[model samples]
Target: MKSRAYSAHTLSALVLLASLIPLASCRTAPPARPDTAPSVAIDGSTMYCTISWGKRGAYTLSGQAEQLDGSSYSVTLERLDWFNNWQDGWTEASVPLEGKLLLSEAGGSWTASKIEKPVPARTSAAQIRHRNTILEGNQAADLFDRRLERVRATAAWLASESSFSPADGNQFFARAGKVLFPEQNGYPEGTGQSAVNAEFKAGEGMKWNRTYTEQSIPEHLREVRDSGTLWRDWEESRELFYIAYTWEK
Candidate 1:
């Protein structure tokens, strides 16, 4: 009976050892690592992304981000009309983005995030002043040109009339004079009267009739007049004559 019991006990111990082997193997095997690399793609207005820690890519952003604390920001991804054409649509999303991107890992994606350090201003005070001055000058010149065009058009119409009276021409010139002399109408210094007077004086003693031709007007105005200088100069010069004749009347 004792010998039989010892054999049974040893068999039971072997069975228990076999059962623990699979468990031991499981514990010793290494854990599978997660797939963690940054990637992004766009389809229409939807943006798909697989961004890993500490990386960034190109993106279009809108709205403001809170600088005081790391907060969520909004971004947009535009879908191109064709592979080589312009964007036709866009997608938007709000995400908690913080810290400056160290490097760009991919293209065709938009990322919106806050940086720890604010970006330095690209334009200086002097540069802003210079740019503003140029814009203002351009605006002033455009206004002057438009006003001069209206005057020229009116003069041309008057000249086309078969019986243009000097009295009517003088009346028209008086009304349009303010536009020709912008300085008198509150324009700044240097935005003085047009070169019309100078041109008229240069062409002094020239025929002051409705028969003025393209060859008669000043070259400067002739060059820029839209409707060829022939009729324009004829009308304009005739009006100038009326202006001079009626000045002392």
Candidate 2:
């Protein structure tokens, strides 16, 4: 009976010790670390950093420099969370730091390391011109002689009370003795035409007789003429027509 009791107690002790072995191993093991530093690059105004851990996962840190100093920049980092959604992370962190930083597996939770200075990408002149063109609302120099011809033809059509034809393809037209100019790409199209129509139909005769001369030209148009690169042969008197007529009695 005594031998049996001792044997039972020993069996219980062995089981408890076996169970605690795994817990002790877990406590003694160190936390996993990344194999290498993050990769960093810059494009335009944005900076990107890529970091990876062995078998754990990989993540990217995107940042923008809000302020630039000598050899360093105050950057704002955007990181992806565990769910892989982008969110704002650190703000105004000095980058290109000298030491390692603790990065958390969860984004926006860990400290980021310093990155190398980024090189500014070169932009082409043609790209600049295209961007400017878009910003300028697509207004180009209407220096073609056909523009004046179209104006004259529209004036004739208005006098004769003829139906407009799509074949004419004239950009400018006249109705009720009011010479109309189409809006440029950047400018509101048909707005000028609508205003002229409204004025012509109000009451009876012509309300205003306006002339567009060199002195009357807008500053931008004059600049276009001076540049002579985009447009040429701007003759205000010949291109712009005078409309003088009263409503029929």
Candidate 3:
């Protein structure tokens, strides 16, 4: 157990750490889209797959384009495999990097109009202790290039009606979960999809229920477990945690 004095010191250290970090190093806007047809096209003819590396870490971006109509297409993209490079090797970490893009045809050429925003990447309080300002402007630029290229390739694959295949996010998640948690049986009670959905519906009338999925029950449980207060808290306030985790961020 952490002493109250130690906890107070930790809080002070976190405050100081936050003030020391530079804003630019912590967050950045996505790179600008090139004006060329190939870079913005949704005609199913170009695809790019590439890795972007920075002093702090590396990530990969790829995408696919699906023709929605004669003038529009839907593009799905993924930025995956975030890794922090260290002296020894690399450490895998979760980072938000999946999104969709909408494109429209104009002047006999396809062009992307907007891209859906993915969930924001976050740094945990625990991580802030050891994290440094990341130099990643070039990395973001590389991701932009790779996204256009991959979209082109996937669009090319869909050029022929016989080859058209749409991407399904849920199916992808199911397959990924199998590989990531091979031994996992199922979600805990009240944590299943339907149960969680019902919990949300019930909380729709509650003023305090600011629906968000970032603060999930599993994450809460993991935090408490790491802090050696899981069992104690579970017995004292399990239901409260469940409802709070279910309906609020």
Candidate 4:
């Protein structure tokens, strides 16, 4: 018993030390919902999601988006790419989702959570963080390109597992601007926005591979991973984080 006790103590101490190190990063704490239900500005940004401690035992997270001028902003908690679908969108009051109550509608404090979807190793957060960001004006555009790439990959992943089908890729991207990435579509496009797309890229297979896959061979996603400058050329485009969650608490 004494030996086990010492080992446990040492383990706890190691865990704490690891958390303090950037390399030992942990999941972010989702925002908290307001208890008094104050009037939160609906201009842009501001979203929420659920952070479960265990199975269905969690609270809702609510927060606002912070970003540069003229661009969009958003905030949200974790979510799931249940069907491998992704959305490059934003949520003002809660995490972004479909067939859900608006943050304003829910009112008051709620449970928080997050949606963790598998991203391609090449396009993962760590990878993008290391990418060249030398340009000024094109910095935002470059990030957008990275984001769109991830979005497309995740959506394609989702489509494979879900009834979504292949033909839905472009459709998903088109409607995603409105459904998944709502704030971008919410505003006129570029008045401060943030969006999130928490969907796994459904690997191409007869059955959905719960594991991450790579480019089938040598081909790559055209237009997204050009290894050069990328511009947001959508007829009208905006930035937003994909975050939101269901909170029954």
Candidate 5:
């Protein structure tokens, strides 16, 4: 089949978060028995239930991080409900997962959320057909992986530094944003199927720049707690300094 030309725009991103350097992390949902853990548990945070609507489904996972040297810590989750859009009667809340992999490291903790699944997009049969064609046999995988490596290196570099560090929090976020959604190669088409995406950037293009200690978390969280409406839902904008994006290209 003749390869169709695809638009060159970046949309997908890979995030390599630093596992909180804490005494411990994670809090799984209450188990049926003492030995069973229905939720995911981190230092102090907990995520319960499947990524379904407001209801805590069979699998609940959450994590908490207590700074090894301090009392104040941060908690983050990468479960189905992490979207924070969890609502009552929210159906089709998750993709049928073969199984979930609990990933924990010195950096912190993270769950697959959807496990290599693309957050479904609204596309017509015609659109799907078009995507199937143009997005195929392209070097998108290479670009995606390359992007991930860059993010990993960038994150690692940032995490290694001390106070007044070389990379600021906001700066790290900006780098992350770019890594997840590079302006160069456009979005990745598949998690996987082929290495079509890998043909573009082999060595490197933009050496990610880094800076440290910068943040706008306070103002962000305050706005969320006071939004009066989507307060709990008001998780984006800044304090959320965290995000994930998937692509089918």
Candidate 6:
């Protein structure tokens, strides 16, 4: 026999797969009914799920069981958030579990029979045009040269913010429903936006050098809302502030 080594990425995938194994192969004998819970009380039964990604951290899923029947149930789960162990906190939005899962108990664990997942959200051509229009009016220079790294940095920061915000995880991070430019991370108050902003700057090599409170400043920004596919997905353009502007030194 020969020894083998697995890379961190490979090990993470393995762990995630292992966590899902029980969901697929669950089996069990008839369960004892509790005196307090009725036969169909499963409708309101909630389940919390966590999928570990080894060093990457884990994803949390939760939802109540609906349309219960015997050991069978229809579960509509929403991915709560992604905890990035590397960041010591939630850092990304996870694709929400889509479709009603037809679940059944086999080995004392609930197993999904049929499931559907949503596709990732992408910036549409229309959205790009709208963003361009706004920036154009303000004579903002496009950061096309650093698009790749900047976009990647932007995505990570946005996901991290979404994971940390107490507001609707599916909506874009905003202040009073608006994206404030050049401010200290325009999130709700007392939510440690400064801490997150520091991390974003240090880790991503991006920082805001100016601030504006005038009402006209917002006119130069575009807020495009779209369908969100994950807990980390952005529903508006405010979530992509980095992509929208390239603050020059």
Candidate 6, superposed: residue stretches over 4 Å from native: 1-57, 86-97, 119-249
Worst 10 residues of 4 by lDDT: 209-218
* Number of colliding residue pairs in each model: 3, 2, 10, 47, 57, 6
Instruction: Please list the residue runs of candidate 5 whose C-alpha ends up more than 4 Å from where it truly belongs after superposition.
Output: 1-134, 164-249
Ranking by lDDT: 3, 6, 4, 1, 2, 5
Q: What CA root-mean-square deviation does each model show from the true structure?
A: 33.0, 30.0, 20.0, 18.5, 21.5, 19.7
What is the Å distance of residue 132 in model 4 from its true position? 11
By lDDT, the better pick of 2 and 4 is 4
Q: Which candidate number has the best lDDT?
A: 3
Candidate 5, run of 10 with poorest lDDT: 10-19
Q: Give lDDT tens digits, candidate 2, residues 30-95.
A: 111222333333333333332322122222233444323323334444332110101211101111
Candidate 3, residues 163-248: lDDT per residue as tens digits? 22223323323432232122232432343443244323122122111122223323322332333333322222222222112111
Better of 1 and 3 by lDDT: 3
Candidate 1 lDDT over 112-148, as tens digits, reads 2323321221111110011113222344334323433
Q: Best candidate, TM-score-wise?
A: 6
Runs of candidate 3 with Cα error greater than 4 angstroms are: 1-38, 41-61, 80-96, 108-110, 120-249
* Model 3 TM-score relative to the real fold: 0.23
TM-scores for every predicted model: 0.17, 0.17, 0.23, 0.23, 0.22, 0.25
Query: How well does candidate 4 score on lDDT at residue 56?
Result: 15
Q: Model 6: per-residue lDDT, tens digit, 1-249?
A: 111233566445434532432122212212111111111113122342332222333323334555455566665654322222121111223333344445555544444433544212221111012211322111211221122233344444443453333233234334423333333344344433443424221112234322222221222221211111111122222222322221110
Q: Please list all clashing residue pairs in model 2, or write none if there are none.
A: 137-186, 205-247
Q: What lDDT does the true structure give each of the candidates?
A: 0.26, 0.25, 0.32, 0.27, 0.24, 0.30
Q: Give per-residue CA lDDT, model 5, range 1-249, as digits (tens).
A: 111121122000001001111112221221111112222222223222121111222222233232322222233333322111122211111111122333322333222332332222211111001111322112422322332333233334334334212133355445443333232323223322222333222123232111110121123222222222122121121212222211110
Model 1 regions lying over 4 Å from their true place = 1-135, 167-249
lDDT of 2 at 216: 28
